[model samples]
Target chain A: MVGIVGYGAYIPRYRIKVDQIAGVWGADVQSYRKGLLVEEKSVPAPDQDTITMAVEASKRAIKRAGIDPREIGAVYVGSESHPYAVKPSGTVLAEAIGACPEVHTADLEFACKAGTEGMYLAMSLVKAGEIKYGLAVGADTSQGAPGDPLEYTTAAGAAAFIFGHDKILAEVVETYSYTTDTPDFWRREYQYYPRHGGRFTGDPAYFKHIIGAGRGIMAKAAIKPEDIKYVIFHQPNGKFPLRVGELLGFKKEQIEPGLLVTYLGNTYSGSSPLGLTATFDIAKPGDLILIVSFGSGAGSDAFLFRMTERIEEVKDLAPKTRETLEGPKVYVDYGTYAKFRKKIRKANE
Target chain B: MPTPARYWREIPQRYRLEAGRCRRCGFIAFPPRLICPGCRSREFEIIKLAEEGRVISYTIIRVPPHQFVDQAPYAVGIVELDDGVKLMGQIVDCPFEELRTGLRVRIEFRKIMEEGEAGIIYYGYKFVPA
Candidate 1:
């Protein structure tokens, strides 16, 4: 019965249109927009990073969970862009949420699926009766090389899930992970941005693991695609999740609600978790949801969850993911975007 | 560079906005002190300050400090929290022209500054338009 008690999402209010970025490189704007199915992508402020966004998301989660901060026994943050390379991001998050001194904290890294790894760990800890509550957060201020194709999709966002057995919002049915030694994408030590294996990141890395984990979880849960009301997959681009869903026998309508990559772009570790939070904002009680996430190291974590009646009571406790996505966004040009992301070297440098 | 002790010591005031209220004369002090400035009272109570506040005054730093050189021409302000405590921090996520006396604002956790090229990052609270 250990499952999500509450969830929250944070999508930064700044957006840069595909046309805006394409204009800088003299690339075909129409082609990128059509190819990726993404109109614009979120950008984090210079001050905002993985730790700050994680704290904000975790705060909303605590509000929705309606639980004491002291009651949270563990805090796990998953991110590739942790502010400090040596310091643990989870400790800062836990202290910010007032869940300090007696909390187990860890900063995890597994590319796009890192957040779900935290979720899986939190659920396990809660189910084991060792902890009353655990908080799992996936957040990234993801970076891409200037003028690279990855810049168009790598974005900033965060999502948090509070796990507890009491007052469950989405009851966990089963979970599974499919992983292998596939180095489709990687950022080596001392590297500021990640490098990918170009087209190789597609079929062999993301698609294979996601499909394998998705089907494996459904089989383990003894359910078919038609039995699930909603589906969310790790969205490296807007097209991947839709195509993967159809490949797994899910209708477009079943995956559309959670397919937010068209707007927010790929938030790396926050990708699938943010989609799940958005789905939860609109899902009805008893609706079954299937979530599968792929990380490009590579691996996929799949989960089957059933919405609980308590969802309605707490869904509005924090800001909705859609509202943040559709809210008034301050659009920035390339120069400003570079300044905000600290891409341009200062005169002093 | 901010030492580990300095960052650790300021966590209560920086992270949680925990201030100190004097037992005598009811004076509040940010970055909580053992002796109240108002009455020199040794007795104090820890108080969590209100998140919402108003801008009392502001200054745009056109020539910035070392770590903030790239982010020059940014606005920093003195904010008066609803609890009557005032703290100085940067004003973010708003246009500089819009900054005025008594502008409604809310505090958010943000990176205050980085120490050096490869030093511990210092995070603190900043004011954003509410």
Candidate 2:
């Protein structure tokens, strides 16, 4: 089965709490904390970006896979915050993980669901016997306009999966995608921050696509929600995944482990994939996992995975997603956040 | 200095930490020289360097370079890897007052500099207190 051989995730250590952002705007901190269900959000350091985070997570994925990087033939990175507008982050990530000199690399952008698009491609390449191994990464140093509500939840992080036919950690049972020409959120060319249609990002965008892909994949796999032991959805906020999970017939217990938006916030492209990584860390052999991702351009990708015995052997090979989230975090104030994000014009400018 | 071609050529060393080791005398070079400084070895083996190292020396730059004016008063240091190769880089995620000789550190990939507004971003290794 062409499935996940190994997986890894990275969440930056710097975090900014809701109160900090709320204080800057003189908004109601209690309402944002209660409404978003996000206490704090991960923030990338001044030196960290999409490429660097992708490399770090990819390295861990390679280690867990225990496959020679040279043997991998393809690498794909999905992100909205690629450091360079034109450069492919896949090349940098592949080189960093020692998969270079012979690799097909591409950078994908489909908003938050782009990472799963990379995963889908890798699965196809591996199952077709066209490549011995392939690596797919979803990562983003997500952007938020100053004083925007998005600033409270948009965060920085990455997740990577190595796909191969042998020693499978989770077998790919089925996959599906649901898409439309709905414009929920977008950032124009040369725009530093994104703009959203507020409430319009809700009904016709995130929910419709997510539910369509989830039900479609489940139907294709010939399984119901009760058959799956775990479920993870693209978490734009802590509330959305929980609400979506319930709407899709999943219990709260099934969504608990993968519900990381409470701690890490929305990692944009990394959202669902990072949730998947966290689930893989805690899932057992023979467990079934259902993952559905929603992107801002109004698309969703869903996959059904069945865990294999090999998962127990390699789950501990890399740092756990929870451990990274629980590691020592440096909290930044609004002034420091402005400096780190370069929101304030410098003397040179 | 931060041109696209120069950045492209340096990626293997800067991103992957790939170095050339002299097959003759076991000497390692960071920039991957053609001839080994030790034993004048003609043959070399490509190797990846260990991520962890020690801060051999450091300097706090208050009067910064043109591109680094915003991030001034930062600390830069020379680190000696376990393989005995020394490389110079910025010391980050640590307090300036805390930086000193013999501090244990680990290398991390980071943005080193940028040319100007809307310019190419240069990425390389930086040392963080382990």
Candidate 3:
């Protein structure tokens, strides 16, 4: 019954409202508000990046796990915005949490699904008895081009999960993955911002993969939507997850707790993992949770988890997802956001 | 070019807030000293310094060094940790005017500096409002 032993999430303090971003490009704010269902998105401080956020979240996870950091045998970080192109984010995270010298670490990228990929690998390794404990993190300081539609939602945040055989908070019952070669969104090497296929990112991409994995996992686990207490889908936006949930026979109530994109925006690799963290915040013992993550290269990784009594003990060990989302947020105007995002060009040094 | 070895050697302190506490006099040293200055103790225990602290003094760097020109006007402060170890770091996530002696803060991992646009990024601890 290898599963999550501890989990933690981190959201930056700074935020930029949807209207503020819309006003810059003279886009209709009401359309985005009504359509995407995103209000404001988190922004990372200049000093914060993928690695920094991952380290913070992993620290909280270590605290919650209450296990010796030296016991962790593997560290994997999933992010599209890793600070160094070559250096692994996992190594820094491992060192920060005092898990160095004995840990195997790697950085993963599959767009938004990268985090779940790490989760899948870590859980599998733990289940196989290949490691005593494994740490997986999904985090990103996602990039969007200036005045591009992606700018409104591309945001920063991170979530980490520690997998082990003992003290399981949520027991992994089943796992499923659906993937294909779909070029819906991509950023070329040396490109600062990603380019997307716009409407092409829908139906054939996010929806198809998510529904395939969601239904596939439900079938493999031999459970109906009514049997699950909560469902979290990779939330590129508030609308997509809701619509997809309904399509998968889940009610609005079951999906709403994890529907954080309305406030947190799209944190890329952090999206679904953060949602699962939020669901874990309120889920009870014996509750069933289904988390399905979608990445732009076009794939979904779905996992079915059954909560254990230990969930109560560690849910409050770190900052709750909702508390951080609704905590004291420093709102930045578009100009400040541009500066923070480093949109303005400067002369050569 | 800045030497990576210099940065590499400080990983224990920079990444984990590791310090050396003298076994004889209980003097705590950041960067983990080889010999205790207080009691001349050669033996020590490596420990992590307290993460939470309070500002004892601070100065706003309005004109920063070459590497930190963009981050000028930031507040740098000396902090006294709960364990009595004093250290200097940048104070962030608060208004400059709000900073004062005795304000509570906690250490957070952050990017301290990077070498130009394409070099090794140095990460360390910074103070944030607790």
Candidate 4:
């Protein structure tokens, strides 16, 4: 009964292509295209960031939920690139959505999985009757070091979910998390960009935790891979989600709908959650979905959900995820991208 | 650095597009006013301005203020919302050449200004192609 009452997603319209980036660093473009399976990635405008994207996505969610923003009793925003290190992103998010003054709010950080961490907390709080409605958002204006591999996919976007006991769209059936002391990726305090363990970030980090959490949630829900109509795994790149889906016994077709990294790139905390929103855009009632998110520290959070009839009513109330992904996009060259991302240091600085 | 109090005080209008509708004359005020200009009535109702609108006038800001130097060559426009409330805001995500009267747009939340590297980030509405 306690589940998603509404959901929404936001992706910045500006994009920087792989060739544009690869040309600057003299890296092979085909490798990034055929290897990583990422053609281009979204770029946030100078005015867009984690907080702004979260507020936009949350507004869409409030519309889909058809509930007064005042009804939201709690708000949680998960992101790695919060604008201010000291200020809480949730306060800004809650206030923009008109959920301020009476809502519990906080900002969460756990790499890419941070968004689902917020989702889990909000759902739990709603199920426990601690609040009438809870808002969970996963958003990021993720950063990549210049010339680093991460630059190909570190992108900007956000997804928001409202959890409540009534008018449930996706009923939460089971939740599970697999975490460890793995340190495959990290950013030190005062560091602008993150450092990763390279090949070590694989096998030992993303794959291990995702598979562990995926199987654990399926077992807890007493369902088989075939029983689920769709599955969304945290997509750091276009290749990982497909490879991991095959390893987890899911068909490519079942995973393809949520495989958004091909166009939108990796939105960090927004990855799996955005995938879920995209799936909801087309999923039929009674369809079962399994979502698993991976974070760099590292860990995975998995949840089993069943679509309800109400999904048909609210799915069309706001902009669909694919519309933004495939809609009008402004492609920027490397120089313009550098300027927009603040990669160039000014003489004044 | 500008006072954070000025930014904080505008949150309701800047963050939420809150407006005041004169209860007496039915006039909508962008930043809710204490007294209605139409009828001089103090009674007003809080309402949200419509998010979708059309461009009534526009200009390109090639030379900009210090806060927007990096974002120069941008477009600013006066949009008349569907609710008949007119307001001015920056028009984004559209090419300058394409901007014209009666172009459709919608309000989106965006960063308006940031004070240096370590100051308050001001957020508000900007117009984007609908």
Candidate 5:
């Protein structure tokens, strides 16, 4: 059976406080920071594109895997935030990593869950024996308009996974998915920040969809929430998962590994898969991991992974996910974030 | 020098630096191509960019394209212009060591390189910290 051999994650350095937003808007800071539980969120620099983030993550994944580039046969990128819509991000990634040129490749997009969603695809392709090995990358440098609430939360980061029929750290035991025309959040064309149903998304959208998907998979696999050692959910903010997880009987211990979004912010497409990689960093051999992803167009994917004997073997990866969180920041004020997100027009600077 | 036809493929950038903003997806292309990469739409409006920004990240070209070998050791950075557009160019008019990650820079048309060995010049935009 094919499974994940190596994993890596990347989060950008910048952070913005909701209080800063509150400061600019002259809104009440006590309410924003206290309620949001966000001191800052990340932002990607101008030079740092999704391509580079994937490349950076791939470098770590490759190093962790210790696989020769020539041995790989495929590459897949899943993102809602690709740099060039047509120029395959997978192709650029292959070049960036010096992967063998003849690799079978393509890019994938399924909104925010695309990263882990791509992993499921790669697992299928690799298990089919159509390819000996493969790589899947999910990355996004999400944008938010100046002084907007998202400006304090929309962030940047990436994660990559190497799938092969080799020393498996985690084997794909069972998988499930729930998708619908759930457009709880969306950004219209040429808009910097996305439009959400607001409180509507909080109730029947995020909490309902994420828990429904997670609970559905647990039932399908005949596993209770107690059977899984950890749970990784797509995080858009600090409270959503905690609230939903509790309603579903999961404590902080079960979701701690996936709580990265509070520090890194919403990575859009990279959110859930990144949480999975972080869980892998501490997971013991023989542990079981349950993963779920939610995106606003809206959809969710659930997967159950069983850590194998190789789990510890692959643990010595460069810049552990926690260390990588200690970023190399490109701290920008509201104006720069606006320009980075391209919400404002310059007269001729 | 006139932009080569090959370069005009991204007209808003090569000619006018007009980024194509997706009416549906809200993505902007720097070397404004006709299609929006974000949502694959054809609708857009011209917006002038602020030619000033900061060096979010950059690298020194110890090894560069064949055309820029003479300018090795120069800094090339991605600057976030005031208009929310990010542009890439060499950082000129300052000591390379002084060019910090968040340095403020303004864009100006300058000679990037010349193909005609020692006698000709080619001009393009380069960043100078304001």
Candidate 6:
């Protein structure tokens, strides 16, 4: 069976604190940690966008797999924000990945689940002998309204996975999915901030779908909650995943390693895969991992994976905290955050 | 007024912070190139850089570009920008004795050189102490 040959993740160097957003809005006083379920979030520089992050992650994934990029037969990008509305992000990615000209190329968008959805598709292709190898990537730079809690945690990042039949880092054990049509979160055409059914998002939609998906996968695989070595859930905040995990019987240790959403906040599409990559960093050869994704407006995909011996050969390829993300913040005033988010227009000189 | 040949291709960058970058890694070439040394992607992005950078390395340009002859004894250094990009430009407004790695400098738009005898007055961004 085809499986994850290699994987890599990226988080930009800059992070913003949720309290910083609260201080600017003058809203009800709340702990930043409680509000966004995030303490800090990553920010990409002007030049670094979804494409650049994908390329960086792709390079690392390619290296970890120890395969020539030209050997790959397909490239798929899963992103909400493509640089040019008309341009193909997959083509730029293919060029960067050095994929052969004969490869198939495509871009997929299924909110947050698109990354793993692409992963499964790649597995099917490579498994069926349609292609020698395939690449799947999920990356995004979501916009949050300035002063809103989402602004504090709606950060940027990328993660890429390569799938093939041999030398797999982790073999796919079982897969299950629970999809639904719920308006938990959504953005319309030309809309900057996503319109979300706030209460609906946190409780009924996210929790329900995530819980359902995890349970479905667990039940289908006949693997009890204790059997999972690591569980990575789509992180909108620090609390949701923990809540879902506990309700489903996964203890703190099994889920703690991937809770970057608590610190780096919600990276939209990048969150779940990056969380998985983090889990892979500490995983042992026989470890079984479960990853669940929650995308607003809304669906969930759960993946069951077992680590392979090759994962131990190179341990350094994993998601990490950037030094800038650790730097002392500037304690940005509301005006500056507004400028940074392009919320307010400043008059020209 | 500008001469035809100089006006068409290489004239402008001779005066400022314009350079070609590797289409692949986005690494900018200093004396810009037709082919990027980084990844060698034939295609490239053209950029007008911010002049101010930290002194990555330095030397007094005791020998100067022909156009900069009158500006002898000038200090030259490689400055890495706050943006994590590195580029080369003359270090102005600070004495040669003061220039060192990690020194803060600001970019000022100015003329770097002009071709002799009937060249357009060149304009470029140069680094000055912030």
Q: Write the residue-wise lDDT of candidate 6 on B1-130 in tens digits.
A: 5464754355335433466777788887755788877677788777755545677887887787666665677877788887667767777646577788888886543345545534544434466665
Candidate 1 lDDT by residue in tens digits, A37-117: 998899998889999999889988988999998999999999989888898999899998889999999999999999999
lDDT of 5 by residue, A106-150 (tens): 888766778877787888889899887789888988766555666
**Candidate 2 overall lDDT versus native:** 0.90
How far residue B108's Cα lies from its native spot in candidate 3, in Å, is 0.5
Q: Candidate 6 i-RMS (Å)?
A: 13.7
Q: Model 1 misses residue A277 by how many Å? A: 0.8
Query: What's each prediction's TM-score?
Result: 0.96, 0.96, 0.99, 0.99, 0.73, 0.73
Report iRMS values in order. 0.8, 1.2, 0.5, 0.5, 12.9, 13.7
Candidate 2 steric clashes? 0
The global Cα lDDT (0 to 1) of model 5 is: 0.74
Total clashing residue pairs per candidate?
A: 0, 0, 0, 0, 12, 0
Every model's DockQ:
0.72, 0.68, 0.88, 0.94, 0.03, 0.05
lDDT of 2 by residue, B33-112 (tens): 99988898889999999888999999999999888876788999999988778989899878888899999998888888
Report lDDT (Cα) of residue A333, candidate 4. Answer: 96
For candidate 3, the TM-score is 0.99
Chain B alone, candidate 2, TM-score of: 0.93
Sliding window of 10 residues with minimal summed lDDT for model 5 chain A: A340-349
Regions of model 5 farther than 4 Å from truth: A190-192, A327-330, B1-130
Rank ordering of all candidates by DockQ, starting from the highest: 4, 3, 1, 2, 6, 5
Q: Could you give candidate 4's per-residue lDDT for residues B17-116 as a string of tens digits?
A: 9999999899898798999888999999999998999999999999999889888989999999999999999999998878999999999999998898
Q: Second chain only: TM-score per model?
A: 0.93, 0.93, 0.97, 0.97, 0.79, 0.66
User: What's candidate 4's DockQ score?
Assistant: 0.94
